[model samples]
Target: MSDPVRCMTVCRVCGKEDWLDVLSFGPMPLANNYLAPAPSYDDEPRFPMDVIVCRSCWLMAIRQVVSPDVLYRHYVYISSDSRQILNHMRDVANLAVTRFHLPAGSLVIEVGSNIGTQLEVFRSMGMRTLGVDPARNLADLANARGVETLAEYFGEGLAGTILEQYGHPRLILGRHVFAHIDDLTDVINAATRLLDPAGIFAVEVPYLLNLIEGNQFDTIYHEHLSYFSVGTLRRLFERHGLRVVDVARFAVHGGSIVVFVGQAESQWPTGKAVFELEELEVRSGLTNEVAYQRFAERSGRTMRELGALVRGLVSQGKRVAGYGAPAKGNTLLNACGITARELQYASDTTEFKQGKVLPGTHVPVVSPAYAHDHPPDYFLLLPWNYAKEIIGREKSLLEQGIRFIVPIPEPLVVSNESLKDAAFSLSHG
Candidate 1:
């Protein structure tokens, strides 16, 4: 006899009980819980991260539900670290202002606004920006930097408070956060109530199609409760009396989309992109269980290939180091079973994560100066999504014979002459 399947039975979106088991990453710790003083490995907590597909709604999610308090109260991942992300947010804000005809002095509220990066961009555009974040430290930092932010989680109750204080917002947005909420129903319900009738409610999330097609299995962690597709998002929004009017794809965070939504009765016309993408997803079997099963199979092969590559390098007396200390990097390291023994140390630009050790693997993290002073034979590109930025910034290292190992869509080593001056090099073994 085996243990019973211990998780939610009903889907979060639709009240459907039909689910298909797709991928299981087994027991894993919180990806963002990097240890500053390096806690004892024996004391760390690991939760089962088995992902399942809701056949009725086509929503993919991890059944193991970790409380928001456990994962986000002391959040360490800040959006201000990457210049690329900042520039992307600026473009999003500018587009929103132009498309929606938002005037100066209009209210803009962002949920899960880490360090208020996006809100800062909105404020500079003459909009009165407000941020709601659960992380106390980050909220304080944002407030100190002139972004009016409330250190509280957004919910129906908070929505009432915002309406009372600031009135309805002209625009409400959440970037890379719509998937993290365990109770998205409450959040969406609140957002609809707080949004002005003609206001646009924009959200950016990791697209499920991109995740499966790009082989970004490492993005699956306890923090990300759901992987969304436009089809599922449309259904979810429609259920709340909101319609997704416009959808645009971006090359940020592997692949993502900014969905513009408004009240069902609003005048914003639905764009053809939404239906086109939805049809593409259906054609790709995104709503089918078999596609997810195949994704799981492909992910297993990737883990094995990445492991073999790292072990082979280590066996040849080559020193390996990680380029970034991101949460996705932690998931990739733990899923592939790489540790400090194989990867000597990881380098990061974030001052907070620089002196810490990775959550599960206990891999030490040091400043980029360390890697620059004593370059490793191989620098594993942990934040491979930012490969272009990293390679361009560290062009000198490539010239000094330090090769980069990109472990995404496929595992490859980059030391080719043609890519010496390029953003990222791709040379497969």
Candidate 2:
């Protein structure tokens, strides 16, 4: 008999209580990266791929499960892939050290330090640094760069070991890693234990408001077990003996919030930005199911419009392919009901994912070189946040006659010639 099909109709955060049937993105496959059908794995199971809102807490999450080991191991995503990110990290590192007045030899520990990108910035500042990450290849790679990395999944046990061996960290940082852990209790407890009495925990996650307001349903894939708003975060951290003191919005990953946390009883006043978010959540009835129902309604509409636009292009005999093979792209593709047949392929600069196919859709990923050699009629920029960067870099290809298509907010068609010199222009202006 085949494995039983699992479906989710309730809220995960509040369990069965205040269960709100928000929005369903319909059936989507396991979108970490599509694996090929091999004799060793003849028939693999796919999840329900539905995301529901907890009417009680208003937290949004996927309704399926993927082993953490399989999700993170042999990871392909790298932090240093974009030039914009490099600059962002540089500024963030300098700001962090100066704002906190981090003394020399003060420990700065990063959880999910992918390839040691940000920590390397810290090392340049003469600070003691440690990276705790689960991915074996990434840990090995970080170690190769002379950055001390522990290849173990982080929890209370790892925190215990760290406290025993290295003492408490002055700064604990996690970017895009905070929402990855489902069992937040263990990691939050571990972080509290690993923190110095006066230590600060800095986390960057996609703000739940932005995810809803901007229609970023793609961020709700299997890897992300929780979507956090300031309200939800306040309750979560306080329960774990940690206090969230500040929140800052960043342009990275579409729109993200960097929350600065400390021990729960600490006397730090909440930042104005944090208060603004809290009030926003209150106005939206963040703890109620009504807001989620409205958000879900709009999201389905957006997805349909996007799908119609793409399909219209296909019906016109235009050759369309995608740019930037991102996890968010999986959600966009899935929401738009895009099959491999609709998009010829997606080109990624990341060598690790270049040759591998997309996790569930089976859309092959190619290098930017593939576009140069076999230019298509349209280049669909799925990671539209980095559209300006990608479009600028691929100006040479546009010079050879390839058009750029951006699908966010709404589908817009633009040319590379005008945007080719944009980064420099933005810098000078």
Specify the highest-lDDT model's number: 1
For candidate 1, list the clashing residue pairs, or say none. none
lDDT of 2 at 118: 92
TM-scores for all candidates: the values are 0.95, 0.89
Among all windows of 10 consecutive residues in model 1, the one with the lowest summed lDDT is 420-429
Q: Residues 1-429, candidate 2: write the lDDT tens digits.
A: 333343445544344555556666665655665554333433544566667666666677766556776678777777755788888788777766776678988899999998898998898898899998999898999999999999988899898888888988889998889888777777887888887767888888888877776666767777787788887787777766677888877777777888889887765566788789889878876766767777777777778887887788889998889888888888888777886778888888777787777766667888888866777888888888787677667677677677777777556666655556552232110
| CA RMSD of each candidate after superposition | 3.2, 3.7
Looking at candidate 1, what is the lDDT of residue 177?
A: 91
- Note the clash tally of each candidate: 0, 3
lDDT for 166 (candidate 2): 90
Q: What RMSD does model 1 have?
A: 3.2
